[model samples]
Target chain A: MPSAAGPLKTTALTRLFRDMGARMVDFAGWELPVQFSSVLEEHQAVRTAAGLFDVSHMGEVEVRGRAALEVVQKLTSNDVSRLGPGQAQYTALTTDKGTFVDDIIVYRRDEDDFLAPIRSFHFIETAVGGTKCIVARTGYTGEDGFEIYAPPGDALDLFSALVREGSPHGLLPCGLGARDTLRLEARLLLYGNDLDETTTVLEAGLDSIVKLGKGPFIGSEALTREKERGPLRRLMGFEMIDAGIPRHGYPIRVEGAETGAVTSGTFGPTVKKSIGLAYFPSRAAGVGTRFSVGIRGRDAQAVIVPTPFYRRAH
Target chain B: MSKGNGIYPEDLKYTKEHEWLAVNGGVGTVGITHYAQSELGDIVYVELPAAGSPVVAGEEFGTVESVKAVSEIFAPVSGEVLEVNTALATSPETINKDPYGDGWLLKLKLADSKELDALMTAAEYRKYIEEEAN
Candidate 1:
């Protein structure tokens, strides 16, 4: 393997992961476990039962004082005023052009204090193995799960305890690889891949979170204009009809002409197919629209389909 | 075919690209090595040349795509593809579960038997892999 520049940063559970024989890889400058046993196995565990993930690498910021809600509402595209204490809403930190700076979740701890970034259940202030942390009913994976924001010093113990307790229910200590496949199968957008600086919120098909009627905020003008004009392109979900896995950055074609590229793609273990997300002309981004993804030197057959490929029965 | 021992299987000739060939009556059965399968994590797709296609030694023939990356499989020796593992189209993960037995990729009619002399023996391949890992 090629050497990475300088040293890769390690999370609090790095040592424990090494001892457990995890396959480590550099993910966005962090030395994180890509898999413990295998990607497919860990992915299946999450869908069938449960899985624990070390999401300490995800950024966490706490906003306090009297103007917390005002600051959050102005900075994010979602209507923060709608959230009550302990509630969370998936929103985006948008650029002026209605594109994303970063997609985050906002959790209302109180009228004056808030923490962020996913959509789903409320945040629970609890002590796990005597370690005080905020457990939020949120995750990138579409499965029912909680993301715990713990103090750095107490992360390892908290993670280990959760694994021990959850093991009997078939919980596995999943790594980034499984995390990625699971999220993609659920049609969750990854930051750098699906929601980059150039792609607008409306184009990403996340209009539900963009509350224009809530009043002025970052990117509102551009979003309002774009909404009036109608977005020319849209992010679409597709599955390979041929025997090849569509991958990130691979060129996508429509009728032998290069159109766009795959933003996120993988062989979904649970869905049991090669699924991916890519941008397409709005007119062409419809269910049953046939296209081709260029995989290696070949044009693999594919077709647009409804997203959230795997949904929880509940 | 020489009945061999362990994962390496002494009878199989190896390549620097981590592919193995089991020779029997001028025909060679090809598959990736144990080390290769384990390193690949999970094999999701396998692209192979059709029967009667020609392959050149040390040249690209097909590709094995794992969950993480794709690796090109190289020809161990020049030959005509006699049979391909069609079952792998749907069950590629079999390569990770059994790299040497049911995971065999293709059967080829060897163009030159002397090419076997240039390939690594099981013992030499093991030592080569150890040195390469470091």
Candidate 2:
């Protein structure tokens, strides 16, 4: 039987990606390239040079009305009042328990207009190679790059144009595989992997975005209470001290017993080590804390470490 | 990748699982096919049974880990493990760069020379992969 949701959705650049011999995979119900050349190579390119990525699967929303700010402010955890015209910030739509509905970027285009506030967006609306797109100085990867929000029809053209221009400068077309490794190295949390509605913002260590003094909003009550009580579990970073790649859902052990679960883990190509993120008891989540990650049913030694494992030189 | 030179040597016998065996006397050297390595992308780790271990034909003997996934390595024919490619422990990318030569995973003292007849010829394996792709 066919899936009730139907077949996977394809981005405008899907055909082009296939034509370029990219290896495709299913990601969040969308057909996207996992890699073109290789994950390691593409990751290095983005770190040292540049890489183009098709993130059209990310949803977009726009709001323009007198009550837009009132609604957005009430819905998001970040201080919407801080955003002036043509500004953006990473924020989250909170559940009633102060957990994430989704982590989003709020782009305030004007006094009562916000454009492209979803998973990612920056602060600019521009054109590239005659194709109009909302070019935001934002990316999931830690590198200084832009996420171009182009119309479905213009996506292929804009991608091609960027590739043509960037080819001489050594820009490889990256895929979701490279995107994942890059973000993990930067300690950027992925929703399904590192966070969910069951985990609160305080627990996720995103207090910077939660404005308790901004007056009551959807999740303010729970957030305030949680803040007073302190988070029970704290998400932290760790690296493998032994051979084996820590993977998502792997069991984390404090000694010989299960303590927490690995949320997102990978061989960070840039860091040249196996690194991961997991939630542990706040008391034991400090850096230099030793732990074990079970890989293929065998516990491997690991150690808690400071996050954002790779920082780009300014 | 390069699809590995697009050559499957006629001197070897192949399994449907994409492993190849070069039999000389009672010993058979084994490795994954070029098609297998190319499909697997970059190999980052290889886990093999230690020498003196016995492996049964059609059973998993070890594993190969790439950046994105882990694949079990299946034995082509029953044999006693003679040696493993220790270099792959630190430099597994050799499987991606040279799957046939330096990337050879294991050597076995054959348990059943007759089992080799059940595997495919290079030409037959080539046809098998072509069908698998479609």
Best by TM-score: 1
**Regions of candidate 1 where Cα sits further than 4 Å from its true position:** A1-3, A111-119, B1-6
Interface alpha-carbon RMSD, every candidate: 7.8, 3.1
- Deviation in angstroms for A18 in model 2? 1.8
- Per-residue CA lDDT of model 2 for A1-314, tens digit only, reads 12357888888998998899898877877888999999889999999899999887888899788899999999999999988677788998999889999999988885343455433344666566787666678888898877777789887888898899998998999988889999999999999989899999889999999999998788999999999989999999999998888889999999677888999998888898889999999888899999899888778999999988999898
RMSD score of candidate 1 (Å): 3.6
What is the lDDT for B29 in model 1? 96
Tens-digit lDDT track of model 1 for B1-134: 11222379888899999999999998999999988888888899999999999999999999999988889999999999999999999899999888998899999999999999999999999888887767
* DockQ, candidate 1, vs. native dimer: 0.46
Evaluated at residue A212, the lDDT of candidate 2 is 96
A-chain TM-score in candidate 1? Answer: 0.95
Best by lDDT: 1
Q: Per-residue lDDT tens digits of candidate 1, residues A105-160?
A: 99888433344543466886766689877878888888888888889998888888
